[model samples]
Target: MSGWTAHLPVLPVVLPLIAGAAIVLIDDGKRPLRALLAVLATLAQLGVALWLAGIAGGLLHSPWGSEIGVYAAGNWAAPFGIVLVVDRLSALLLVLTAALGLMTLLYSLARWDRAGVNFLPLFQFLLMGLNGAFLTGDLFNLFVFFEVLLAASYGLLLHGSGAARVRAGLHYIAVNLVASLLFLLGAALIYGVTGTLNLADIARKLPALTGADRSLFDIGAVLLGIVFLVKAAAWPLNFWLTPAYSSAAAPVAGVFALMTKVGVYALLRMGTLFEPGGRPPLFGGDWLFYGGLATIATGAAGMLAAQQLGRLAGHAVIVSSGTLLAAIGLLGNQYTPSMLLYLCSSVLATGAFFMLIEMVERNRSYGADLLAVSFEAFGLADPDDPTGPDDVVGIAIPAAMAFLGLSFVMCALLITGLPPLSGFVAKFGLIAAALEGAAGLTPVGSWVLIAALLLSGLAGLIALTRNGIRVFWSNARSTPRLQVAEAGPVAALLLLCVALAALAGPAMDYLQGTAATLHAPERYINAVLQAEGVGR
Candidate 1:
């Protein structure tokens, strides 16, 4: 790596940092200037991410080892200096976080940014944290980046300063603070046992551990996984996720769809880091499969039971997490590109859905759900609802409602894993891969996971269908005023999903390559530990 390309990995972190400070320097009254600085900074970050992904994706197929760029800050070597790595997984997620960040930022400009002071600064800082989290190559920097993002999130979630936001933000903070503590404890244990913090260095050392050290290492690894699961909103540990996420400002909630993935990324990244020398994934074959199934079931049931659009989207996030975790359990080292494809598709759709939820309900009357329920229970035709919420879906929607209606339906399709979208393609791929049955996963386990997926999808369909009918068909609705900034971001996200479906073949090839690289840790360990740093 040379020229500007070698430095591409650092820009994702630096761009946001500079933009945030620049935004802070601007007067609060100069909203447009602040907005311009923020947007330009985010756009630049996105461009860098895409460039890095292109380079890393290309490197995935290279005959040589796959390290697109490994930045050794302060001209130091591994285990001593700060390192940022751009590889298949990190690059893929950098692109994801940046794209999602841009959309949510655009949506925020429509109104959410003005809700509080320093909103723009906090938002940019959040981006910096997310990018840093994805790009950092070791547990120490991972914790640092996690704190940076969590600090920013604490501010962002309370942007609107409402009662719900306040309560939810407090809960969110408490839970994450505990997770952070667990992070430290886990890292300390692992470091004590393994004698290293750099991921690559740790991987090289793991195979050398013996007896009680190995046992302690396993315990530390499990603790670390628990922290990730809590962040990923895996059931039992995920109680704080829904209320906090749903109560946030719409744009905050939209961008937050990436937060859960941060957890999944850590799990996926470190799970194999401990399984040195082609041993089956240390954590993948363990409790992750059953835990994932439970999470999916819980999230699906929550979605069915939710009346609020925001909470439904939150639960849908959980369902997506469950699906991915289950796959990680069953497909570790087997390398299913389909799983990666599903991940990208689901995150895009979920972000779009969260953003759209606020828009759909922007003009909704309070107590609408209760009133509809009342009418349905008594079989009375309420004047407010020409077609009651429970009425069969056969209403002719006015032209004014077309965009919202169509977008809502698209969201429904994406969430429900229905036909003619990336959701169906991704989910179908997952089902097919499961049926094939891999090394550690039994045929019965594969079939059980398949059933869970199908059942979750069915639950989502019923819930989202009921939601759509309630929002568009049953209640009389007038179009809410929408800005180009607001609609464009949501449209772009959904369009990306459509593009994924349209270009499934090539996308799967790239993702499969990613999965294959992930299973092979030798390449990662060598690239990181043997990199030629500055002044070499």
Candidate 2:
């Protein structure tokens, strides 16, 4: 933790930004150099994240005196100027973002073209925004980081600009732009109320509100929540997700796995800021459980309705998003660490599957009709020469489809809070918190969550089975050779999924510790304040 302060939180963002810009300046023909920069930038971020997490954990362990690692640019103090703060919560999220960033980069390495116009630069910029969002102590700064992410995503989403890609990317951008506008509006209103945009300051100031001002403040908070809910793809606001995500390039979709979670992080972070010290922050309880219930239902229905793998994966993402949001909304500011724990793993798993969808697509040579025909006709297209175009039907991909099917089934269970996955751990924490909140009044909300969780699991199983039976069992043939370039990165991503499943115990403990520190922002506030000469 010694040199940790010197590097400060801003270095994480800066490192990536600088790297991305440098990548853009590199000659496109130099693919190897570009890849090197991309990988190094990602690795640098990972190292920073690990170091920051360790420092944060150490600080939290010794209550006698703990440092949150606050560094003010140009020695400027908080409330009046820009500041960066790294507490246990932000530190943990930084690690998640970093790990995911690193994984996505590695996935793209063997898979994506390094010499592309926007790939490396945009990716690095997106990380810059993500790290900034996690570390910034100011509301306006958060907005800036959000835009940084949005801008980079705009390029990444439309990378190839194929008809499907362009259409999906446009929708994604339009929907999020509106959301961004609303976010700005909400921030403006909050500034009007508190006269300061620092989150900790807002927290301290919001507690003093009363009468119409309190109502106004609550309304602003709700508006801000709406923006994040949209980002997180919560029920009514999630319409944009299906098209946008379904049509994107595989790696692009994989990267977006981080975007929606940004919404979750913002919601959790801002919710904690708005909530005062004490019992679940007033209306937090209802928001968490009810929102979660609605999200679960919608996601389940979406999956059942989806037909194609891409669309199916898109819907699954929605379902996972809803699960995380509902959990956080239910747990309030206090137990969000548990929610985040599940969220991080779920994001990774969802991302890996999304990437896998592309790989599966690459291996196929026939259209849906051809695939169906293969089931009926004995002359199925040759799996080895998918390009044969023999027009034969009635072939099958029993093995390949079966593997893909299992992955889908596991993903569904993972998203639905089933055991042996990180999803279960996250849900467990939230459910326990919800029951405690209910304190036993028949706990209608808790019952609703239980039912929703069960139903989602069942729905996911049926959906996966249905898809699997069609793709792997009944027909298929006409296969293509696996592109090692693409296959390698996807395999790497899958390994992450296995690790998440296998290492749930240590991950949960880390999450619990991070959650505890988040609930008590004294360390966070103190870290920033102390950087400005306030007492330890």
lDDT by residue (22-106, candidate 2, tens digit) is 9889887787898899889888888888878877777333221454767666666777888887777788778878877777777
Task: Kindly report which residue stretches of model 2 are placed more than 4 angstroms away from their true locations once superposed.
Answer: 1-5, 59-67, 114-116, 277-283, 332-337, 366-413, 429-442, 483-485, 533-536
* TM-scores vs. true structure, each candidate: 0.91, 0.86
lDDT of 2 at 430: 65
| Candidate 2 lDDT score relative to the true structure | 0.71
Off by over 4 Å in 1: 59-67, 277-282, 333-335, 365-400
Q: Lowest lDDT 10-mer window, candidate 2?
A: 366-375
The C-alpha lDDT values of all candidates are: 0.81, 0.71
Against the true structure, candidate 1 reaches a TM-score of 0.91
Q: Each candidate: how many clashes?
A: 0, 11
Task: List the RMSD of every prediction in angstroms.
Answer: 7.1, 6.3
Mind giving the per-residue lDDT tens digits that candidate 1 earns over 3-27?
Answer: 4455567889899999998899999
Determine the backbone clash count of candidate 2.
11
